[model samples]
Target: MIYDLLVIGGGINGAGIARDAAGRGAKVLLVEKDDLAQHTSSSSTKLVHGGLRYLEHYEFRLVRESLIERERLLAIAPHIIWPLRFVLPHDKGLRPKWLLRLGLFLYDHIGGRKLLPPTRTVDLRQPPHGAFLEDRLTRGFEYSDCWVEDARLVALNCMDARERGADIRSQTECAALIRKADSWTATLRSSAGTQQIEARAVVNAAGPWVDAVLGQSTPDKPHENLRLVKGSHLIFNRLYDGDHAYIFQNGDGRIVFAIPYERDYTLVGTTDQSFSGDPSGIAISDEESLYLCDAVNEYLKHDVSPGDAVWSYAGVRPLYDDKSSSNSTVTRDYVFELDKEGGAPILSIFGGKITTYRKLAEHALHKLGGFADRSWTADEALPGGDIGASQFAGFLAEAKQRYGWFPADGVHRLARAYGTRIDRILGDATCLDDLGACMGGDLYAAELEYLVLEEFVIKPEDALWRRSKLGLHLDRHAHARVADWFAARKEYA
Candidate 1:
């Protein structure tokens, strides 16, 4: 059987393409070398936001499209994507106040924002927003962006694609591609074995490995299309009380975000350093960690050191090489290289942010015209995201009311992780005891079963870390227990 679309890379772009193609009545097969979203997708700043900083680089189109997608994503997946107000504390040394104000004004209007509130001025000397900031910072501006469960976005997209008759394979690498006159034959290798699959078209959404994947098909055609920029993030114990996130402006014309994460930790990040090394298991460098700490210390009242970070992550962005002198100045917008000179078309994706992934999928499919039907993902809810178009607060209230027997905190976690599918996991369980053995933290047996049976969660890391961040909540013993559970399970064998 020939798939209509074969998508490589299991990040946001690949999953989004698979979901879009499958929903549009095309037979799609998506193969991920590692676990889904094990790298870039899971390691993002985790915001469905417009590139507010991209305005300085004159990326109006990207910003507008991102803002628009932010709204669309919020409606489709309110459980995972919701509004987050960002507090940008005004620093006298960095960007001028006038420039910040002007940028916020354009941000408010440019993307056709209606549901989210516009930007507002705040006095940093006052309570909530500015209470954690240093005394030197007196004023700031607040604007709206949405936070996303980045890995789950990829997972749910794959789930929806599978439900729509697409073959989703994790831990499967596309080793070779032989472009035929009418089709492309791909050799997919996994621990189980190598399997050759044929597809009418191929979408190379291989984030940092875009060139490598293309090189497999056209080894002689040298392509220097990606500018790999390493971005590192640190996770510290919760910094402040408020839910509002901070976007700090640095002296070096860059911005770092400190977001509320996992309900117990504060997520601080992202240094843009040029990286040329391999993209797997990338860890935060000492210099990058110190830079992040210093960047946040400049604005916050409480200073943090490298030792204070409990966890840190690094991801390499395969940005389109725009030949900008500095790494930070590279475009966040995506570019596609569609090659169809002698055989079946292959679209190679480069340089995209999490916010615009859905739209990026649409554009990618549109580029590979005649392979599938019209766009359908703009309105369709993701697999577990069909909790009506109602507000998240309303959905939470409904979940609490329906599952009154379950612990409120547990239900809340499930709601956030599985969304409407929480019911599917809970099933007929009327009490906590019905949830089978508690593996660790909120990691219950029933939830693990759902992840294994429904989502493609094969390893303990797949469940405890990527699919859900229960790893942060679980202790060393609990993590080991979960690992043992996976070891004994037949699925692991």
Candidate 2:
């Protein structure tokens, strides 16, 4: 097939690039070695916020752009992106309250924030929010940011790309790429065997393996230099009781976040360590776990440990290398390198974040100028995010009233995950029983069937872990039942 752009790596950058290009009337093909978002994209800190710490590095442009994009995402994907308030307890001896307050003031005025509330001060000794905090802490600063289902964001972007006439090939690897005079030929390896695609342009958006893709995707340049910094997050059962996430300033100059996650758990993480090995091999080290535990214990009254962790995941950040002395000091801002070899251009994306992906995609395609079509993805709503600028609660009530009988849990899950596409999935089914068995909590046989038939989900983990976090709530029996049922469906197909 002839495509205008071939995007390698189905992580957030690749997916977002594909979605934006496809939306703008480009023929696009997205190839992922594994399932979409099965890597670093899924393992994000899951916040759509301006990096408050980046201010220390004087990254004013990055912070300003991120702040703008954060609000844009909340507007476009309200179902999955919701506002989160973070509480940063003021440390008396570390940095003066005035400095912290000044930072917050700059953050508030960084971009013209519209939907989210402004920053405020909190007394740690007071009732409600402070009751759980340690007695030593007295003052706190609260600010606004948004939380995103990071994995789902990638999936939704790919789905939206597919909806807009893009071919999304998951579990497919680009084994080779050869430049034809005015176009490019990508040799793709999949279970079906090798196939060649002709594209006018190719995007190397592979997160940590960007250098690998440069070597593997084409032979023009042996490699493009990028840095892979390993970061890890640990999930523990509820650390305290409030909805607000705790942001702490460690003595080492690194910040840690104890964010409320998945109802019964608190997610804490992100250590910036220089890594030399493959990103796939990077996991939470024994020392890193101890470091995290100590960081959490520093602020909380109740200390935490690895034994308290329910689960943990690690990711490698593909940062643009400016030869920073420390990994933590490396810029989080993205860089684009355009190679106009073989008439067709190769756009290589260096560094970016979940918060800045939409803008990054827009900027990437704009850099590709003559090759990529023109359209604004900023104003566009992603797949399952087409409530057309309506209040989420209003949209929810309306969706429930419209599809009221399709098992309350199933209905909510479908609408929240797929937005308007839920109606198509329901089809002629009028009642709960008509939708099929309840595979688990909130997951129904109907949703699984819909996924296999439409969403390119093949493995149980694809549906359970990435498509939905039903695995966390599902018992062994429920997981097995879903697996067996999925296997039976595949057998018939």
Candidate 3:
């Protein structure tokens, strides 16, 4: 079949583009070389916020766009995205109080703020702050942002795209691109085999491999547009007691975040280091681990070391090389390189944060010109997001009552993970037996079945890590059971 568009990469950008294009009535094919969000998209700081520090870089446009998209994304996918408050303590050095206040004011008003509360000043000597922070810190500002299940956001976009008639293929590599005068032929390889497909246009949203994919299409050109900056995070057992997160400033001008994660852990992270190696199987480096620990130690009274971390993860950001001297100063804003030079058009994406993905997708399509009928994904809800923008809590409350037979915590987890679609998993089950064997904690065979059928989950890691963070919560035996379940099911099939 000749498709309208062939989108390469299954990260947030690729998925978002596929979803938006498909919703506009285009026949789209989205292919990922590996599992969706297995790279940079999943390895994010996992916040949907205007980059507050970007104000210092004078990236006013990027911040405003991100701020605007932040609320839109929250409205469209409230279950996976919701409000989060961050406490930025006013340290004596670092950024001055007046400057911080001015930046916060811009962050609040620039995007026509609504739905979320405005920033407020707080006394660090009081309850939550006093107990968690150091005695030297006396004041801080609490500002609003949103948290995201980063991988799930990518999955939902792919699912929605598939529902809208886009052919979503994971573990499929676009090995070759041969652009014709009127169409482009793509060589796609997978476990099944290799095949050639035709598309009117191609989108190279291959995050870190954008240069590699671009190289495939144009062999003569040396593609060095990407600067692979590795960012790593450490997961510790609940560093502080409050639901709110802390943003700490270092003497070297970098900021680190300590956020509540997965109901039981504190997620601290993200060091900016220049990476020259392969972007696969990346993990937190010792230097990054110590850097993060030191950054946290400078702010929180309870000091921690790299040994205190329960888990660590890393991903390389495919940032556009703006000739910036420092990795941290590299622009988080996206840049698109549209080439209609040789024959058919191929648009390659570079450097964007998760907060502005929706707008990036919209703008990507706009750059591609007549690939769609109309722009429709902005206001429309992604799959399972129809539980009104502001109504997730109500949805969860009602779900707990409806599935009162199930564990309350399980119901809450499912409600947040699947939104109104939780009913599809529970599905008239009067008791636990009807849901099938419990693989671990609240994980049941029923949810697995739904993931396989609806969310494109094929392997155990896809289920435990990307589709959900069950890997962190479930025990090693439970992990084994999940692996066994997949193995047995494959054998039976």
Model 2 residue 104 CA deviation (Å) reads: 1.0
Q: What local distance difference test score does each model get?
A: 0.90, 0.85, 0.93
Q: Which candidate leads the pack in TM-score?
A: 3
Writing each residue's lDDT as its tens digit, candidate 3 over 361-383 gives: 98999998986557687789977
State TM-scores per candidate: 0.98, 0.95, 0.99
lDDT digits (tens) for residues 122-155 of candidate 2: 9988865566777889998999988889998998
Put down candidate 1 lDDT per residue, 1-493, tens digits, no spaces: 8888999999999999999888889899999999999989998899999889989999999999998998999889988888899999898878989999999999999999987999999998888755688998998999999899999999999999999999999999999999999999999999999889899899999999999999998777979989999999999999988899999999888899999999999999889999987899789999999999999999888999999999988999889999999999989899999999899999999999999999999899999997555878888998778875456678888899999988789889989888889888998888888988888666778888889889999999999889888888899998888887777776555
* 10 residues in a row with least lDDT, candidate 2: 216-225
Best by lDDT: 3
Error of 1 at 301 (Å): 1.7
Question: After superposing candidate 2, which stretches have Cα over 4 Å from the reference?
Answer: 217-224, 371-373, 388-390, 401-414, 425-430
What stretches of model 1 exceed 4 Å from their correct place?
388-390, 491-493
